[model samples]
Target: MSDASGERQSPAPFLRLVRGNPTPEEAAALVAVLTARARAVQAARDAEAAAPAPRSAWRAPSHPAGGHPPRGAGAWRRSFHPG
Candidate 1:
């Protein structure tokens, strides 16, 4: 039980099952099952921080080669071909 930097601590599994001393109704049923497993891990971290937040359907055109279309060599000619 020496904790304040005195070392020798390790006992927590509910203090090693109350090292043969539990009576108060088995320590109030192990503190109501460790407080319902700490309220189910804080309600799963508040439903993962209220979820929803993931969107990106490709988008990055504000000029820099906007709607592309213009590169040398008759840009794939077609204005009445058949020569």
Candidate 2:
């Protein structure tokens, strides 16, 4: 947002100490944990976004009722499609 002169306004603080006062080191530790957790969550999101989407059941290879086709010529190709 801006004022009458169009000067940018700073937003409210993202973190606030509502309870007991903590030493600088303790506060840093808390912030480190929160920041690490946030980064880990973001990394997971990034990995999921980069992953290939799952194939639909219709697009998935058809397995034999017995699980795998018997060993024989064309068995490999037969396992991938419905007869």
What TM-score do all the candidates reach, one by one?
0.30, 0.60
Per-residue lDDT tens digits for candidate 1, residues 1-83, read: 88888989767675346367888898889889989999999999999999876544444454543345555678656333423
Estimate the overall C-alpha local distance difference test score of candidate 2: 0.84
lDDT of 1 at 24: 85
How many clashing residue pairs are found in candidate 2?
A: 0
Alpha-carbon runs more than 4 Å astray in model 2: 5-10, 61-83
User: Which tens-of-lDDT digit does each residue in 1-83 have in candidate 2?
Assistant: 78899999988877888999899999999999999999999999999999999877655578334565656898777777747
Q: Best-fitting candidate, measured by TM-score? A: 2
